[model samples]
Target: MTVDIEPSRAIPAHSWRRWVGLTGLLLAEAMNLLDATITTVAAPVIRADVHGSASSLQWIAATYTLPFAIALIPGGRLGDIHGRRRILLISLAGFLASSTVCAVAPSMAVLLPARAVQGVCAGLLIPQTIGLIKAMFDGAALGRALSLIGPVMGLTAVAGPVLGGVLTSADIAGLSWRVVFLANLPLGLAVLGSIRFLPEDRADRKPSIDVSGALIATAVAAALLVPAIDATIPPWARLALVAVGLIGAAGLAVHMRKTRARGRDPIVEPSLFRDRGFPAALLSSVLYFAVSTGLVFVVVLYVQEGLGASVLVASLTVLPFSLGLAVASLLAGQVLLARTGPKLMLVGVGLLGLGCAGGVVAANLAPAANLAPVPSLSPWLPVSLGLAGIGGGLVTVPFFTAALARVRPHETGSAAGLLNSVQQLGGTAGVAGLGAVYLHHTGTPGGALAIVFGTCLAIALVLAVSATAMLSSPKDVGQP
Candidate 1:
């Protein structure tokens, strides 16, 4: 009935109960992480089997992310308005059921609907994981808890490719690509056992669900995202999609203005953006991931084409990056929140820029032919990735830490939603813009990839400068 999370306490002296809660939350978060990612690898397989046009395949993937992205803020608000434990449990159950539907889907028609439902469930669970962490831990201990989050994200980011390859290759149950969807089942069930032991969190004051604001937001996001994912459409169709998004955005703005005129709570508060740090961090994330995710795409091509490695070999080579992140993410989180805060982010972003540039140089020079045995070009990719681990960890881990400190208590849901939306938008744009850059210059694919990343490196340097500007003068990062 009521959900007011007690500020998170310190990580309990190592204990089974504390560990169980941590694991449960991690598994829950992974379901979202793995699902968002793994399906992309499976998309081509589904297209081959389901006999859909390329657009349908895109829809199958976009339907999930679009809804999930559109729904995240509202989902977090729902948990706050109701109860996170109840919502989390319900979200997990719904997600599992949807996974089964996707597993058993006979055609694109059946599968796409299931993906949308699954995304909605993910939107519900993902933010609640952060909310639960907020509820359960505080101060330095909270930093530790937040730090643990990055590793699961890191694991899934790397594991998605390797795991998808294995499932597609094995086809042990004859499920082929569908095995990826079905994989969520065990992870879902496992979370149930752990969630049973999770402490319940209910807000003391429930806010009214802003249905109008939610509908508007969804329309705006889907309008923009749906078109971006469907690349084969005519130029006019593409323009139409952009127009639709602009109109939807306008409608949402007008609605919010009306709500504000009447003194009701708008889903996205204008005041939240007024803070210097909020815009600074948000813009930084947009530019950073735009380059970072694009780097992954380019590196995949560079290793296979420029370096002349097999797909399997190229995929496996990326492991060092994740392994590096798993090692350093939490430590970086501790350093950011405890010692440096904004200054830490500036350093992290700076390293990311340098590593990306160096990695580019390395990839160009170091080919598999140069290294012995397995062969590797530019061994710097892994080292670059390792350095990125610190940068990525610092930029992200402090996000929630800073959000909680700065946002009005009631707007945490919106804050979380905004965070997810920007993060996803950045990734989506990176894939599109960078992928386009690579494709448009297919005759010189390696050059295309490098150029895209080189551009991103410059942008990242600019972001680092912005962080320095915002965090130093105003003390806007820690103080509300």
Candidate 2:
């Protein structure tokens, strides 16, 4: 499973065309990121308009992410076989079509299915960005391009909620929340128009698809994700699903080894795990994202439900965090990372832990809600979140850069897919685990928030310790 760029079609790193192509890839990635959270603020409005059950509302969000996560490995393999440019274009087209359907959907039935299609397309599209970026850029150019990804991600996290609220409130064309889906159209079309600039690259030799391995992998992802997303399921059932996922993971590993033994390409190469840094990077990603995602979830709930703030105000409160993230990402990528190496990640973890401690203090200091129309949040809350975001920015790009550093050129697509899959799983786990902790102490909102932040701080400490041990290995140090 080695990819070779078509010599005639190869775009040079110095060419302006490559930058144009990179823009298209980044936009596509942003669409995927935005959709993941954009619907959160608008979910209530959507449910009311479509006459959807509470369960259906949950399904609306779950359907997109679950399929996206499940299809990632196979999607990356498809790019390896059929060429990244072609797959990206096809997937982008599908995403546009499905998003249109979502905008026009008159019922939950139509909307949920359309959202599922959008997720599948996003899965197929995202890996190609990483694949194409690696294919197109090298040296300092690669670092610069990769640096931009963290900022875009951080900004979009803020944009999703704020944009969703604004669109829904604006009630464009009297469509209300449907406008959120409609918003993807212009961005999608702009990227679509840049198709000609993208380089075509694929495997040197076509390989048979590992049908058994793909199915097993999808099943394992579903088993794990379904439980995490749908809290309505009984505790015993969720545990059973987790057990099934673990067993399936074991079976999938065996199947991949057997498939590779028979001289066929498995969905993921077994040899990738032999890279000690790759596994350590993956572990760090899981820990980092779990805390980050969980912290966001808890903060949003606390601001709105606990503090009795309006949705708009709640969304606005997160703005400082995103701004801090954007600033820190640029600093790390442009200046700090090239000189500091893995040591920078430790600094990030320490800052994040300190921010979490601030969050605990802020939560304890929150004023009790009164009958006033506008509720007041503690000043320290935004400051703490911003500090945490800065830490997140510091780690995000370096983590991706480090994970792929030791990977062979041929393994970029698969490695990118696996890294992304771990991220999604980590986020889901964080939401389920931390959300439960918050819910348990809902009667005491301040106390619940304190507990959540304390938990995040604890996780940050553990991640710092693990990262120290991981980076101490000679193989893992100063690679990028």
Candidate 3:
């Protein structure tokens, strides 16, 4: 006689429960994304408090991303092995504790370490959100569930700088920069309570940790990020670190194949790189993210330090860019994507390059007659930033959609985890690489800003050409 078996995990059947689950997930994500850029607006203030060197400022920005990029794959695997609901709660608790630590941190020594912990917690928290969405909903529900990420992302993008500026300026009980971190507590606590409404889900197959793969990935990221902080080091030392990072990467590739051949889980599927569009899409994303993230860091500093704008004014300068990004992202997904596909991304990137050029010209044209610290220029600043924001909006959806269009259903989880990892990794690279160049020219910030923007513009041009060649073949415009 055949026996019937019931699944161990419960799936949410009611629409309201699923929506509640989604709200919790989005809330968690908003916190993470908010933390990403929020701290950036307050970086100068934090540096002043800590009396840190330029390198330390880069560390403050880049350290969070270091562990975040490294821990992502393993974190997702753990969620599958244990339970998404369980892992998410634990992660949020850790995030809350870490935020408290950050708010009370007495020194850069304390704050930086706390920020690193926060990154790992964020790494853990993010994967569970995507996993829950995938597990809870299917068909139309899944589509709607996934669609929420875009707007939430855009909303957080707009909110991060403004929130940071407000919190820092508010000086809540003279907390100043600490408010940016403290701000997370209420949202995290609320989400922790709300998560109980979500269904508990776990993978059916037994999940195993890829310890070796994780270590190698961490080492590779460390080697890549560390040298970017201390640029005064000898050329040979930097090259040696680069060599070490490349070697570690090679080892990781070999290890993944061995793991796959042994029928064990790898951090990522080695074969996913074989797709024609996958590698280019991945490269473009890294480039796209590097320029996008590095631009924010550079612009914030330029406005504050170069132009001598107050923190609040500096924050306001970024507002137009963020708004443009939201509007463009909405249009890209709702309208332009159906008609233009990857070509739209090319246009966006090109516009971003143009925007960078415009910024350079505006900064160059700053009047010497203005005794105020802030530059007296025409409307170029807002217009240029708005152009960059729109460019970001145009590229975000198409790149993600195209990258995953050919991904197999079974590999979706791994693909998503790996892509997110790359995105974080790319952000780290932007801060470390570009921030180093910016710091090196601190005495001549105008020249430094010029060089940094020039580098981004060059990368954007290359992205446009390479992406065009790869995506040239006629495909369905509405495919994504």
Candidate 4:
């Protein structure tokens, strides 16, 4: 039987359907990003309400990201094999159901698992966002559609903490921290309804799923992640877990090579890394995301538990950072990105290091009493975070554009999936790894924060040095 595998015509740029579909996609994108960081501001509240252990707090965030990172490649491949619209709808339904579970969860025990399911659903939905863009538009039209995503992403990141704080503090219907997830129900339904407006595209030649590669990759990620979750664990035991993780990584490399040799598609295209610049770009993406997530998670705790800031106040304290990120990301994507991709990233990374150093210094300057109220330190706190945010925009905006610069049309889904998955993985690792450090030093919040922020600063500087030497020129990234 013949299947409806391709669109008859590109959707017109001015058509109502096109805008509606774009709105749906953007809403979905916003919701996903919002959920990612919204919990940050509410995390302390959630911990108090649930009476959860410090580790549970970390799990609440890390659990969502781990599955998300692991599932993205397969999620993208599924969209290619089936249809973008079909997979997107399925994922959204799962997300809504999972959100409902999260909203009603009576304890941390139930909530963590529900959040994992939500992350998986997010993984499934996110890749289709980019894949649909590729399927719907081409040439300059494609560039225009894609350009809008950066600003939207920045806004969502800026808005997520504020929204979370408002919802949690307002305690809508007296649901408290649960309102964050409950709020998504309406938006989820709206996106589901608008799915009809999105263009549907499927691969003409369906490829076999790389089941073994996926499983092996999961093993690799898990071997490191599971052990890192608990700071109380013995260092010797954690080292063993790291060894197992290394073995799994080696196994994944071997299996992918075998798959390629057998002329079968692997979850990750080994050929993609053959480009010297692509691998460096991918590593830089990982470092950038890890630093961002880790810093946010730690800062939320420091602000609320250490500085005694209310949820709203804590969220507002971080607002300037988001504002800086939004402005810088828009500028980078629009102007600096085309002129000096690597150079701009270097500047961004350098700023990130300096910003992080400033935060570390601010943490040190704060009175170690652990009972100080909001506005504890100088204006330097937010300023430093804002500088870091600008660096974030500079690094990320150009990174995505540069990494996918040379990707072929047929490889679009795979490339987007791999890149996005790495980003999620970086976030997952950051929360898990740095959260451990934060928890281990909880008795002294300032000291813990100083250590974590210091680590971030070091990583940023290292990446800046590496990117300066390794990343390609702006022309190389922008060329077809």
Q: Which candidate is the best by lDDT?
A: 4
Task: Please write out the lDDT profile of model 4 over residues 290-383, one tens digit for every residue.
Answer: 8987787778777887778788877887787788888888888778878875468788888899999998888777666445455465467888
lDDT of 3 by residue, 405-455 (tens): 776665666777787888887877887788887777745556677678777
lDDT of 1 by residue, 10-39 (tens): 235444575688789998998787776565
- Counting only residues 3 or more apart in sequence or on different chains, how many pairs clash (N, Cα, C under 3 Å) in candidate 1? 14
What is the C-alpha lDDT profile of model 2 across 28-127, one tens digit per residue? 9999889977876676568778998645544666678767776677876788788999999999999999999999999998999999999889988987
Q: How much RMSD separates candidate 1 from the native structure? A: 4.6
Candidate 3 accuracy as TM-score: 0.93
Worst 10 residues of 2 by lDDT: 471-480
lDDT of 1: 0.68
Q: Which residue ranges in model 4 land beyond 4 Å of their true spot?
A: 1-14, 370-375, 406-412, 472-480
lDDT (C-alpha, whole model) for all candidates: 0.68, 0.79, 0.79, 0.80
TM-score for each model: 0.81, 0.88, 0.93, 0.93
RMSD of 4: 2.9
The lDDT of model 2 is: 0.79
Error of 3 at 351 (Å): 1.0
